[model samples]
Target chain A: MKKLTTPLKVEDLKDLKAGDNVTITGYIYTARDAAHKRLVELLEEGKELPIDLEGAIIYYVGPTPAREGEPIGSAGPTTSYRMDSYTPQLLDQGLLGMIGKGKRSQEVKDKIVEKGAVYFAAIGGAAALIKKAIKSAEIVAYEDLGAEAIRKIYVEDFPVTVVNDAHGNDLYQSGRKEYLQWLKEN
Target chain B: MRQIDAGLITESVKKMVMEANYFLPEDVYSTIKEAQDKEEWQLASDILDKILQNADIAKNDQVPMCQDTGMAVVFVEMGQEVSIVNGYIEDAINQGIREGYEEGYLRKSVVGDPLNRVNTKDNTPGIIHYSIVPGDKLKITVAPKGFGSENMSRLKMLKPAEGLEGVKDFVLETVELAGPNPCPPIVVGVGIGGTMEKAAFLAKKSLMRSFDSYNENPFYADLEKELLEKINELGIGPQGFGGKTTALRVFIEYYPTHIAGLPVAVNIQCHAARHKEVVL
Candidate 1:
């Protein structure tokens, strides 16, 4: 697995092909459907975004309530396709990466290549395992959206597989081909 | 008639909700564990390992297994001979759901209005279903429904002439179309032969059945096995990344239907098929 930091460099992503397992550290922001919508609207109106998009990676998640003294609650990626409409808008703003589960639309895939952005697939439904990698978390915007609010979270060795890389490779379609081929051969 | 305090139902629901979210049921946990051995894909096997560990953490720490702790879905089998005192049964169950959600720190996911899009905040007004049976006992089953997979659920009305082939095709097609979005290694619940709504309800209800349990109908039992194999062959694998196990099982529940319409519903449930039952 490759080790990289967010606000990623072109070189950092260039060598990373689709289906390559990765462990990303450094700052990453969290946003789901509601937060993505508002962020896009802000961009359209030429208003200041809550966070700088120039070198940021976004995760689609809305965590549960944290108990007192906990860093955050069980945090996992929500499905990615729900944010498909707003993704191109965010990608245009120099967003470098996205972390979530599921397949993306063809339009989203085209934009990922055009804007030199990447999409990563975190394991869906393994929230507690993912939560252990989070070092800290704080809401950055859209707090009124409840579980759909925006939050900035720090993670260590946050595991993901590159689902869509900037050069136009797609893993969601390709992630299982090897296994299927192997089964056929055996 | 036996008198039962409504408040007792409330307390039982609260406990069940907490338990359902925190503890992965035995059937689900074991199936996932068994999948690790059978999974040929490395990534799929790795995912199964993490899923098993995630359940352990939730159980030991008393935390929700997933962030989407799920919308409370309470299924009550009410006895006709019992009398509920001091409150309505539904209200008591909702009261328990609110407490479990708030006190247990589970995420409140229900929106007050689908279009207006406001969080209900306390997660009240659980999706409660009731069936009146013969005995004087209340059997409450708390099944927290998560939308990751729920969003992928589908229903179809086919011509009676379409027959078994159509039913099989629809179920397989729904799972294929859902891909990784519903979180693979899923539990597919098939409700066939009912009217549209009843079919959908049966599909959701089938998810609450343990994976190891057999359907009384031998034909459906064999069909379930066939469909399960067909799904795994899709190679959707764990979390849709690809693997040997696309789904843990396919459950079918059927009822008598009209001569003209054959309705089948597919309710896709995530690997975290959490449910707890209690009799009061």
Candidate 2:
């Protein structure tokens, strides 16, 4: 598996391709549907974003409350498509990576290519296992949103797969085709 | 006739919700393992392993299997001969869910209003379905319904002329459109016949049944097998990573409907298929 650290550069993501298993360390900002809307609203109002996005990676998640003595609860990736409408704007803001599960819209994929960003798929329903990689988490903004609030999370060796890459490789397409071909031949 | 306290109902719901969210039932666990063994793709295998590992962690840690522990869906079979003393029965169920979510640290996912978009905060007002049945016993089952797959669910009002093949096709279409989104190796709940809403209810209810459970009618049972095979062949696989196992099971529940209407609803449940029961 490839390893990457946060505040990722264009060069860091440009070489990544779909289907590569990656271990990403460093900070990934957590934002789901509500936080995305608020972030864009800040931009519209000519205000500073809650967190700097320059070469930043964002993870789409809404975690359960942190139980006593734990950094966080089952903190798995939520479906990513809900952020599509607000995505290109985030990409434009120098966002370099997105960690979540599921297919990206064609529009978002195009922007990922344009922005030299990568979309990584974490295992859905594997929250507890995923939480093992998260070392710390704290709400960064939009606290009223509860679980959906923005949080800055520190991760170590967080597992993800490249679903869409800078060079326009899509694992969901090629992986399925390759698997079907293997199924047919074997 | 025997009577039970509404507080007892509340207690049952609390236990059911906690246990169900914390543990992956054996059927789901084993099915995932079996699929992992047969998976041809390396990624699919790895994903399944992680899922199994997550379940283990949740069980051992007493934490939820998924972060979106989901909105509590309580299915009640209340005896007609018994009455719930002290508070209303619905209130009791909601209270149970309130305490369960609060104490367990399961995320309170319910929103107060769809448009206004306020978090209900305590996960109150569970989606409850109640049926009046024969004796003094009350059976409560809590299935935490995550919106990831619930949002992918669909209902179609097919004409009688469309027949059985149409029902199968609609379900397949829904799964295909859902693609990798519902976190596959999904459990497909197919509700056939009845009016529109009843069909939808049955679709959701079918999800609570055991994965190994089959329709008593031989024809429907065979159809279930056939549908499962076809879905697996789609290569959507686990988490839509593509493999030979797209679905773990397909369940169908039917009710008599008006001659003019042939409604079918497909309720998709993710691999997290969590549920538990308490009989009081």
Candidate 3:
């Protein structure tokens, strides 16, 4: 397993390969469908974004409200493809990585390669376990969006697997292929 | 005739909703444990372990097992000999969901309007299905459905000539296309031999059944086993990492259909399969 800290740089992602397990620490921002739409709209309107894009890793999630004394409720990655339309634009703004589940569109994969960004997959539906890694979470923007609101969260040892790396390798493709090959041989 | 209090229904539903969200049903939890034990792929096995751990945490901490506590889908079997007093059945059920979501700290995932996309905020107005059964008792099952798997569900109307092979093909295709999106190891719900909507409903209701149970019909039971094997053969594994356990079970629910059409619906349920019921 590889260990990474957020505010990630291109150099930090250069050596990563598809299928490598990763545990990320430091701070990451949360944004889902509605928040991504708003972020891209602000970029198009030439307004300053509420959060910095440079070296930032966006976690696609919409957590349940935190119970009293809890930092956040069950927090897990949402499906990534819904945000595909706005992802390239975010990458253009120097977004370094995305943490979500499921496969990304080819266009998003191409942009990840072009922009030296990475894509990571958190185990979907493993929310309760994943929430233990989050040390603190506070809504940073669009509170009206409720759970879809953008939150900046501090995490320690947040487990993820490298799905798409800067070199354009995709684990979803290669991993499935390898498994099928094993099935054939066995 | 027995008169049931609407308030009582509301209270029961409220508790059921919270329990459904916070607890992973035993059949699903055990099947996942079994899958983890059998999974040979290192990555797939680890992912399954995390899923099991998440369920344990959710149960112990009394938090939702998944962040998408889901749009509440309630199934009601009301006895024809019983009448609800004090309030309308629908209103009482909605009230129960609203209170449960608030009290449980479950995410309210419903929208007031699909196009306008405004949060309902209370998770009220659950999609309710009602049937009149024989006795004077009322039964309610609350199955909160997360959209990650819901989005991957599909329905198709096939020509009668296409037959059973066509149904099998479509089920495989839907799971293959869904890939990792629905969060395997998924429970495959197949609804066949109904109208378009009925097929869809059967597929969904099938998900409420326990993973270890099979369709009563021996033919369909064998078909369920066949489909489950084929799906795992696709190597979607747990979270699509690829392995022997892409699907924990396949359920088929069928009804008599018109002579001209065979409608099939595939409802995929993620490993966080949750449903709770109460009888009154």
How many clashes does each candidate structure show, in the order listed?
A: 0, 0, 0
- Put down candidate 1 lDDT per residue, B1-280, tens digits, no spaces: 9999999999999999889999999989999999999887788899899889999998999988989889899899999999999999989999999998999989999889999888889887899999999999999999999999999999999999999999999998999899989888899999998799999999999998977886899999999999999998998889888788889989999999998999999999999999999988
For model 2, how does the per-residue alpha-carbon lDDT over B92-184 read when each residue is reduced to its tens digit? 999999999998889989889999988889998999999999998898889999988999999999999999989989999999999898898
lDDT per residue as tens, model 1, A69-153: 9878999889999999999988888888999999999999999888778899998888888989999998888889988878888
For model 2, the DockQ equals: 0.85
Q: Pick the candidate with the highest DockQ.
A: 3
Candidate 2 is scored at a TM of 0.99
Which numbered prediction scores highest in lDDT against the true structure? Answer: 3
Q: List the residue pairs that clash in candidate 1.
A: none
C-alpha TM-scores of all predictions: 0.99, 0.99, 0.99
Q: Candidate 2 lDDT, tens digit per residue, A1-186?
A: 789998899999888989888999998899999999999998989999989999999999999898788888888889999999999999999998999988899999999999989999988888888888999999889999989989999999998989999999888888888889899998
Superposition-based RMSD of candidate 3 using all C-alpha atoms, in angstroms: 0.8
Docking class of 2: high
Q: Is candidate 1 or candidate 2 better by lDDT?
A: 2
